[model samples]
Target: MRHSLRFKVALVFSALTIVLLVAQALGVKTFAEAQEEKLITALIRDDIANVMQGYRANPALLPPFDARLNGYVSAADQPLAALPGSIRNLSEGTHEIVLDDREIHVAVVPFEARRLYRVYNFSVYEKQFRHVIDMLMAGTGIFALLTIWLAYGLSGLLVRQVAGLARQVKALRLGGSTPINPGKYDEVELVGLVEAFNDYHRRMADMIEREKEFTCNVSHELRTPLTTIKTSCELLEQDAAQGTKSRARIQQIERAADNMRELVNALLLLAREESTQNVEPVRLARMIETALAPFADRLANKGVETVIDMDRNVHVAANRSALAIVLSNLADNASRHTDRGHLRFSYADGWLRIEDTGSGISAHALPHVFDRFYQASPEQTAGHGVGIGLAIVKKICDRYGWPVELESEPGRGTRVSLRLPAAGPGSASPDALSAVS
Candidate 1:
């Protein structure tokens, strides 16, 4: 599993806090232990000194003593009896002794006349040390929790700027028109990155604008010559001998000119960075027939029949010119490959589908057919094209927010569909029911 940057930062902060808290607790415990040991040693020595001095001044006064302290004295003939075994061999210094299943802190002082010993219960001081340790642990734990909370909060604050920047970048991808506003950022790297992105975005938009202008100029320039050629072909057809081969060739020239004109118009439509779609109710059946008119002769020459199955009352909201180009290209492509079998067009449930029993695309190539300039293997069939027709269809559909789908199988057939918005009541006319082929 991958962890987010914010989560990793918080974890690191918590770990560092815990380590510092533990170190602090240990230091406090060590200092407390050292101080307690020093005080215990001083208490043992002071108690023994007082007892020895009091015994010299008056032995009776030393008979009674505090419960926490005990002492023993020895003369030259009388050695201290019943003293703990640990104290018997003890040197003239403080020592811890275990007696009667209890620990004792004792200080032994050697004197010329007698040996004096002062003793204390070690468990009493041990209990105090335990209390101090408990307090240290409790304090450290509470502080550690607070430190973690603080670290988490600080990390959130630190990541907010980055999160905001990421959101802006996402907005740009989703067709946001406004330029990115590189606001103030405390981090140097973030500031630099924002600046770089802004610069890159500006250059990219400029390049696209230049490309569109170039395409528009080229298409616009070529259309004039295409129009002249189409006019010349029309005049020649009228004067040529009827049923002559020259007349057929003249028709072919006219068809080529018409195709070029449609291509130019489609290119211009695609070149526009943004377009205002003039939505109106369009007669779907009539539109299909009008688009197929240009390719009818070609379909007849190929011995392929065309079929249209639709309701004349079916109307859709669309841009007429763009829709015409889309349908024309689709019909032309279907007719080109289909040498024998009929091409079918069906409309229902706001969708128009074109199915062709033609040279179907290979499985691998099918997915990429809509990409610009992508062509299948020539050996597959003569229908292998220049590869811009379907791409232009896709571009127009995307502009209008229409959903387009294509499906094909090798040696079987291909189906292309378009889902459009339905028009309201009384939108279609009776004349929309004409046959396209």
Candidate 2:
């Protein structure tokens, strides 16, 4: 009967009503019983208390009164059974009496003439209890309606906030031009979540734009030298008859061939760096030692000091070919730029730091440092280094989802750090860090 809220709430009101109704009923019953008892007591004291005196004064009238009020007045052999009291004293059962032509309740107690009578009646009290129950029912209905109104109001605010976030997500684009704009919220958690999502979406969009521009430039820049080499080769083949002219043609072809070769080689290295992404666990320390072996004679010739602090069992997962190409480019760039300095490489805690103590990249040149065909100002240029190494390093790092951070000050030294993921984050390739380091 009291399981659900509807039942529970209804029951709660019903129970309260029952308590109040019962109390009212009890109070009225107690009052009615006292009134009934008083009436009976008074009737008995006034009429029956002086029955003997009344009979002596008007002995003839007593016979008529007995005949009128007594239940046992057969008019024959009924004098011995005549009782002194109201008709309510006739029996001990439910009884009805007429009061102004309407029914009322009365219970009579038979007792000695000197003792008082007891009477109890309940009909009058029942009416008051019914009104109390009805009042409670009406109040309970109003309270439930109010609760539902309150719940609806609160749910509206919650639903609106959720709808705003949903619309933002639906409108999200990886490379969209429009930026996200999440407004203020009543709740802090919703605000924080919106901010985080907006930031992530913005970063991804920027990265996509960067890649698109990179692809466009690579195609335009590499195509020019390729076309030139092809044209030069075709002309040389068509004019083989003239000896003097042929010699000059051959010289032109050689220069064109070299330029074309550089373009092709650069493109090939970039492709390799992008395609190779897996690096299993390996002794990168040993690999670094090996990489240094080939550079030793060149370092000594340039009077460059080398310091390496690598873990004894240094292991990192990455595309080894790409990593080695990155290292080699940094090293070669270092050697070419430095007038007199040192280089240090360290691999620890899943990071590889390569510091080159050379004249740092100029502030003006920094923005275009990774730009193709970009070089330091010719007057300040330190060597005949083609300005593509840093760009290549950046592309490779991007393909592998690694980050390369650069720190430099003009005339000071430069530091570059590479972040490597542990082997188990994704798939593993061969033991390639050994080759890469």
Listed per model in order, the count of residue pairs whose N, CA or C atoms clash below 3 Å is: 0, 1
Q: In the order shown, what is each candidate's alpha-carbon RMSD?
A: 8.5, 17.5
Where model 1 places Cα greater than 4 Å from the true spot, the runs are 1-138, 152-191, 223-262, 380-384, 398-400, 424-437
Query: Each prediction's TM-score against the native?
Result: 0.60, 0.37
lDDT by residue (108-223, candidate 1, tens digit) is 77644445665567676597779879988999999999988988888889888888888898998787757667666778888899999988888888898899879878976998
TM-score, predicted candidate 1 vs. hidden true structure? 0.60
lDDT of 2 by residue, 1-437 (tens): 33533344444555565566556656765676577656644654454435535545774643332334432121211122333356534464334555444334333323222222222233355455456656655665665566556545555555677667766677674334555555656677888888898888878777867876786677667776677767776777667575887766565565445444444544555643445534456556655665565456678888988878876555667656566666667776666666678888887677888887788887777778778868865555546566777888888788777888887777887888889765564443344533456
What local distance difference test score does each model get? Answer: 0.77, 0.61
RMSD of 1: 8.5
